[model samples]
Target: MNQYPDPHQGEPWQQPSGGNPGWGLPPEPHTGGQLEPYGNPTGGYQPAGMGGMPEPTEPTLDTIGDIAITQNTVITPSGRFPIRGTVWTTTDMSRTEQSTPVWAIIVAILFIWTCLLSLLFLLVKDTKTTGHIQVTVQGGGHYHATQIMVSNSAYVQHVQQQVNYARSLAA
Candidate 1:
C-alpha cells in the first residue's frame, strides 16, 4: 500500500522506483470502487438514452401556385392569440376599375340640354310673318302640315317623359 502514488497527484498506478515487483495501494476510501467509470449508466434518468435528443415528428407539405393572392388580418385586443402564416406563389396582374355614378351622368345630360336651349333661343325669333306660314302650307299641302305638327308635339312629350324617367332613376 505504501508503493502507490497519491490520487490527488494525477499519476497512474505504477510501482515505486526500487520497491518489490507487484506492490501498490490496494484500493482507496471514498471513491466507492475504481474511479475510472464515473458517468451515469442509466443515461441520466432518461428512458432508453433519450436525453439531450429531440423528438421525431412527421413531415409537412409545402404549397405552390402559378398565381396567388393573400390577405392577413390580426386582432389587436388583449387575450388574443398570435398567428403566423406564409403564402408562396408566382406572378399576378389583376386590377379593378371605377365607374361614373348615375347622378353625375344625369347632371351631364341636363347641362347639355341647357346649352342647346340657350343656343336655340339666341338663334330663333319668337314670332314670324304670316307669309312664312303660308309658304310652309304650300310646301307640304294641308294634310302633311297637320301631321307634322302632331308628330312634333308627340316627340316633344316623349322626350319630356324620358327626361323625367332618367331623373327618377337618379334619385
Candidate 2:
C-alpha cells in the first residue's frame, strides 16, 4: 500500500515579522517624545539612576536621661553579685555589676590590698551586666527591648520617663 504524503512536507514556513506577536507589533517610530524600551511601552518603570538603592542608615542610640541609685549586692544560691553602677537609656536600663566570688574578694582585700588582683575581674563571666527594658508600641503590637550594659539607678528612672513620654506621645 502507498503511504500518504505529510501535510507540511513541502510548504515553505513564513518568517514572523520583526516584532514579537506575544508583545504586539514593534512600537511606532520614535516621535519627538522619548521612546521607552521595547517591552514597556508606557516607560512607567524607568531604569534606576546612578546611586541605585540608597545606603541603609545605622540606628542611632538616643540618650533620654540618667539616674542615681545606691550600690547593692544581689545574692543567688550560686553566689553573691555586687551592683557597681547602673545606667538607663531610651532603649534599656543596664547595670554594671561585679560577679566575684566571696573568697576572691576576701583574698583581694586582705592579701592583695594593692588592688592588682582586681584585674582578675576580667576573667569573671557573670560580672557583665545583663538587663533589658522591653516596651510594646501602643496599638501596633510591636515590641522593642534595649539591652542594658553599664547604667545606674538614674538610667532606670530615665528609661521609665522615656516610656511615659512615649505613651503620652501615642495618646
Candidate 3:
C-alpha cells in the first residue's frame, strides 16, 4: 500500500492539503457538547456553558422539610446530634369521624316516594379525618419529635417515608 500521496497524480481518497487529514492531531471536542453528571445515564445531558462545566453539587444531608439528616448527624431546629444508631417510631394520633353528609340528607328528603329505600341514602356515612401523627425519632444521644397534621392516611404515609429515609441516613 502506498503510504504517501503521489505528487504526479492526485488521489481521490487523499486530502487536498493536510498531514494525514488530522489523524495525528489531538481529538477536538464537539461544539456545545452535552454532559452527563457523575457519568450517570439518568442524570441527563446538561448544556455546556461558556464558563465550562460546573462542579456537581453533592448534598451534605438529605432533608425533609425542617429536618436534615446525614449518615452520622441529624439536624433540626431543636438541635444537632451525631447519631450512631437510629430508631424510628410513629404514633398515629389521628382520628377519622363518621357522620351523615348534608347531601345524603337532601337526597333522602327529595326522593321519599320509595320511603324506606330512599331513606337508605341517610345511611351513607362521610368520614372526615382530623388530628395529626406524632413522628418520634430517637437514637444515639438525643431525641426529636414532631407532629405532622394529617389530612388523610396518605399524608401520614408520606411522613413515614420521610422518617424512613432519615433513619437510613442516620444508620
Candidate 4:
C-alpha cells in the first residue's frame, strides 16, 4: 500500500486548505447522556446540585400579607342579609397537620341543624295544631298582618339572635 502526500493536499501531518477543522466525521451525534454543542456541558438534566433541580421556592411572607378576611352583609327595610363570613389561611403541603376552629364550628352547625330538623319533624307530627298570630307593633308597624306560625318560639328566637349578632359583627 502506498501513502503519499499529494502536492494539492500537503504533508500527511498537515491539514488541507479549505477543509473543515473536523472533517466529515459526522459532526458528533447528539446523545441524551452527553453534552451537546452550544448547550450546557452538564446536559439539560439537572441533578440535586450543580443546576440540577431548582432550589425549592418559598412564598414570601410579604405576599402572605395580601391575604384578607372579608365579611359582607346587606340590610333591607325588612331584614339584614349576611352574605359572606369566612376565614382563609395561606399554607402549603407542609401544613398538613394544622388545625382550624372553622371545622369545629362547622360540626356544631351541622349538629344544630340536625336538632332543628328533628324539632321541625316533631312540630309537623304533633297533635298540637299550629295557629297563626298577627300582633301589631305600636309605632313602626309598617308591615301589615304577616302570618307568624307558632312552632317552638325558642328555636326561632335563637336563630334570630344568631342572625342579629352576625349583622352586628358585619356592621
Each prediction's whole-model lDDT (CA):
0.29, 0.41, 0.70, 0.35
Candidate 3 positional error at 114, Å:
5.3
What is the C-alpha lDDT profile of model 1 across 9-81, one tens digit per residue?
A: 5534353444654444444558554444447674332222136464233231211111111121111111111
What is the per-residue lDDT of model 4 for residues 120-155, given as tens digits with 9 covering 90 to 100?
332222222233333221112222113244445453
Query: TM-score of the candidate numbered 4?
Result: 0.18
Count of backbone collisions in candidate 1: 0
In the range 66-123, model 2's lDDT, one tens digit per residue, is 2111223212222222223222225554555767666665665675567676657545
Candidate 2's TM-score: 0.26
Lowest-sum lDDT 10-residue window in model 1 = 131-140
Q: What is the clash tally of candidate 2? A: 9
**What are the TM-scores, per candidate, against the unseen true structure?**
0.16, 0.26, 0.55, 0.18
**lDDT tens per residue, model 3, 1-171:** 567766675443443444566543455666775665686765874433236755243355665546667666666666555646767788889988899999999999998986769999989998888888787767656677777788887877887788777766656
Better of 1 and 3 by TM-score: 3
- Model 1 alpha-carbon drift over 4 Å, by segment: 1-87, 90-94, 116-171
Q: All predictions: root-mean-square deviation over Cα?
A: 40.1, 21.1, 15.7, 27.3
Clashes of each: 0, 9, 0, 2
Name the 10 consecutive residues with the lowest summed lDDT in model 4.
61-70
Look at candidate 2 and tell me the lDDT of residue 103.
68
Error of 2 at 165 (Å): 0.9
